[model samples]
Target: MRKTAPKKRRWSSGGLAAKQFSAKMANNEKCETKPEQSEKNEVLEELNSQKRKFDKIAEKLQSIEETVSKIAKLNDDEEKSMMKFKEQIESLEKSNLLNDRSNEKLVTRKSFVVKYVFENLEKYKFDISKEEEHFSMNWHMEMQKNNGYLGIYLFAEPIPPFNDDWSIEAKLEFKMIGKNNSSVIKTGEGIFEGLDGNGFDDFLKWEEMREDYLIDNKLTVEVNVEILKRTGFGKNNIREFDESQKEVSDVILVVQDTKFYVQKMYLALQSSYFKALFFGKFNESEKSEIELKDIEADDFQNFLELIHGESSVDDDTVTGILNLADMYDSPTAIRRCEEFLLKKSKKSTVQKLQLALRCNLEHLKNKCLSKITTISDIKSIMAANLPEMDLSTSQALLQKSLGFWDE
Candidate 1:
């Protein structure tokens, strides 16, 4: 019975179908699971690659951060250096400015010393009569106290006028004589133009100049003047006259044994005294010869030369001519004298003040008073020539010193 049953082993339909379906499901599950695993492996590999890329980017970012930090520190250091450089430049500029101010002050002081020394010396004259030109030279010495330097001021005056639109070129040679007379201590040369006054000043060390130059506390100077060139206007326009032609005298006047044969009209035009004598009601109107008194012959000659524009009036002779001009009532000559005295008053303050008071010259009096700035200056004036001052003049000076007026 068991053998027959085995041979004909029968199964239920539902049960067999169920078993097949289970096996098929199991195989399908295996296949689906294999593809899914493969896909997950691929996804995992991609994720790993992305993670490595991110790490590399992080490293690059770290390197960039370090470079930026270095740049920031360098910029800070540069800014600090710039601040220090600016401070140094400012300090240097301040130092330069101070030096400039100091130099300017030094220049001003030097100029003041030069001017003061030049104006306070007595001048010496050189006789240039042999030149036959209307040229005169005067010189003075200035001794610098601080530097022991000697300054020689050479002044040339009465430069003769040239033709119209013409100028005269003058060349001068100056020499300093040694104690032995024949030796030359120093020499200089200069050239100038025009017919006005011209001058030159030179400074030399006192130690260097005193050894062979000083003799009896005196220094001798010689100058040679030459007309280097005459420019403008033709030569034919220059008038040449003989002695007889130049002597076109219409009147003769005598002063202290000196005779001046001059044109009456010119004299009348220049002097009120001459005008009253020749043109006004005076006994000498018809006289051919006139005699004058209280005038020096040389001073009168200088006055004549001044009116004729042939000479220059200097401080040495200005006061005498001023008196003569006042006597003759010649306003032009009086004004010229006043101007000359005003220039010389810087060195002769007390004398000028007395003269101003005596002559009642208001402008000159004011100038002299203005120069007296301190008590020491007033004391100096009093010590020099206080006895010469009149009562009214002394009172005025006292009032000025007491602050009664502003100079």
Candidate 2:
């Protein structure tokens, strides 16, 4: 019974001692674990903050990559747009058209008259209008009539065929209104067919005869009435007259609205074959008979100096003569002037000399004789400043005039 009571006490003591030991160990472990857990929590918190910053930086990188791609695409688009604009601007610049009146063609038929008969119309004459254009020269002279037309040409002539030596015959083929169809045509066949050579002189003689006949007949008679009657144009072909029964001084042309008073005078002179009349140096006929056509150009110029002596002159004709004289020295022209130029004005005589010299007319030197003043005047003329006078002459008169008689 005593042992049993003590057992309960022993049990209680043991249980209480165990419980206290357990409580003490548990407290020590709690103290050590609490500091370690706090350090781990702080490390984990810092890791979380670092992870959030990394996530933000990664998002920013992705946005920058996308923006870079957009910028690259924009750059490509700008380049392409600039290229397209340059191409469009180049296509708009190269298509433009001239405006002037003188460049136009001559339109009227009535504008074909002149001082000389046109070599083309051998049978038909030209018709002219009243108003004269500054650039146009068209007028008509009365001639023989053929068919219903009063003209110098029977038909237009063709240019010479391959074998024909006469090339001037081709000019007649100019365009004109046709007789039959009333349309433009080139039916250029002359009514007269004759070989041209020495035979051509006969044609010229025929033309001269025809011209003489017309002039003589018209000068002596009221020929317009007969001409109108012959043309078969009744009252429509009437001629105009003055109150005094005198024919109007103006020429009546085919163009109905116009008339003009253009008169031409031709003067001819006689040449001597012997008996030097002016200064006894040379005969006029001998100068004329030198056959300038046969002489070479230089020889002819020397001959001009011998005949004309020395002269002062101006004009294209004189220039041409001086050139020819410098080159050929035709004695015929030169000597002719020396014999002829006396009692003539320096102006008119010099003018004639200039013209004859230029035209290469050995015969015309005689026409300037009245212009010489003195031997000094001749020397002055020789010394006068002229570009073309720079040639040596064989004529004694010219040599003396130039102070080179010894040379």
Candidate 3:
């Protein structure tokens, strides 16, 4: 027992207690500490703020895409408008360069028909037609029997205070319509200045005309004229649109040296060209005075007058007004011109057909085609403008003309 005690004399109970306490303190030091609730809340708030910023950036990108699409559409529209304007300019330049008669004065034309009932084929008193104004001058037809023949004449009954040196180069045609729509046609060309008339003294032998053309002793005579040239009879104005109209007008339309004061809305209502000019994005839209090119002042006056419900439509002014209407794309003015040409106009059939074809007047074209009942009518229309006549029109006239071959 004494030997075992000396060999194992290494540890005491106090030392064992001290070592266990040290080990426990080291384990407590190695344990991790938890984070504060305030730090966790701050991290969550930061993540939320970053997500909101990313959402805002995405919205901005979508808005930018829409803006780019609108800009692209606008660019395409602008390019198309530029191309159309370029084509129009090229067409005008070509016309000016190639056509010497681009600015040539328009010819004045008229026609009148009369019926004379004769008791016998003998010399009778002069029968005349009511005077009609043409080329700003009065003209009439006179007929009489002389030397067993029916004589017809054309007279220029100009209004007084006339030009002392005025002269008109006229192409005249006279016809005597008979039963079955047959006639004797005579043509003449001359100059008329100061007279009421001049024509054939012996148009045809009265005996032969009575046998072939007279119906119940009635003679239907027609006269047509073309005023090719004139001098000293310059342009005249029917309505004055100067400063006198400034009180009620919104703008000034300047043509050459003439000024026309007018309201923009009134013109825009009747014309597409004026609508674009006054309201569209144009350089001249904001200007107080706009100059109209390639148009006559007198024609503008007539156009305005017709729009204002005045009787400004006549052969002397009809063609010019129509040209202006077509150029300006004015429907009211075009309809007015068409009505005048259709109803009370004294224009020749060939002349009317030519205008209908050029201006695309459907009603007038149909009316003219319906009245073409003779081979002579076909020949005249063909000779006037065969290039412009369409296939359907050519066919219709040809079919009608076949009926008159034996006549």
Candidate 4:
């Protein structure tokens, strides 16, 4: 067996070369596999990013749709409300109860009340021409509740050297009417007095004029009135009537200067009594010896010329005379007022200033048809115009026209 050991065989050149080629191929496969794995991981990350972006876009679209729906609903509601308001306005128009002419209606009401009161005064024979009247009334039911009630007020323009003390008197009587109509009530009275100048400063004067009556279960009523004239420094003198004879009732008025004996009578109306019967104007017939200061002779003569004027005089001429009198503080202003009262119409009511400022014959003629109620009103109006007439004295007159400190 020791002799049989074979000699070691050497490798072939081709076989070794083949073995090296196989090793190079295996390394190339490993490198290609690693690059493919890296590319797959990058593709997966890109897909996830695209999916997240799509989800955000979808959420935004859903929010926009909801907002659009809410906006459409709000628009519909507004349109409905507007239609309802329009319909209501049309209904009001058809009814004619709600008015478009509210200011006109208010003016009508004021004018009507004034006319009513004026007529009532005429029935009372209060000599609207000689005596002054003042009043205030409620504009509404609510005003009546809060401010009491409506009343007609009467007053006199105090004679110069005016004093506050004045007399006021009132009386009342009533009678029941026919059958079951006893529920209706009427009243009558005989004397009334105006407050003195001081009444302007105090409202209690109004309370003194008011009166109330109580009846026992009477339904319908009527009344008769008799007012006698009497005068005192602070109170009125009332007369007692003989219950049997209605005609003989009378009273005497004693003023500081003279005495007035009057026979009083009354007339009946729907809701009130008229205050006038017949009165005779008389001056001191007998007792003339007492020497009291007489009204100045010039004043007395001028007063006569004013109320009873010559008819042929021109209106502008009178206006000029009055304006000059006002400037110099003459009594002629009172005369002009008397003339204006005699020749007044609706058109001339607001022309006091116009005529005074332009003192032309044409302007004065035009003013002939104005409503001039009182001398004081005209004088006040003319005085108000003085500043506007002369530019040189305008500033001074303007200060005066603002009215006195007392006003």
Question: Per-candidate TM vs. native?
Answer: 0.37, 0.16, 0.47, 0.18
lDDT of 2 at 339: 33
Per-residue CA lDDT of model 4 for 244-270, tens digit only, reads 333443543232344333333321110
lDDT score, candidate 2? 0.27
By lDDT rank, best first, the candidates go 3, 1, 4, 2
Which regions of candidate 3 are displaced past 4 Å? Answer: 1-238, 403-407
Instruction: Write the residue-wise lDDT of candidate 1 on 245-345 in tens digits.
Output: 33797667786665677778987898766676677555677887778754455456667766665534765456556656666666777677778788753
Pick by TM-score: 2 or 4, better one:
4
Order by TM-score, highest first: 3, 1, 4, 2
TM-score of 4: 0.18
**Model 1, which residues run further than 4 Å from truth?**
1-247, 344-347, 383-392, 404-407
Question: What TM-score does structure 2 among the candidates reach?
Answer: 0.16
lDDT of each: 0.47, 0.27, 0.62, 0.28
Q: After superposition, how far is residue 267 of candidate 1 from its true place, in Å?
A: 2.2
Q: How many clashes in each candidate?
A: 0, 48, 2, 11
lDDT of 2 at 359: 38
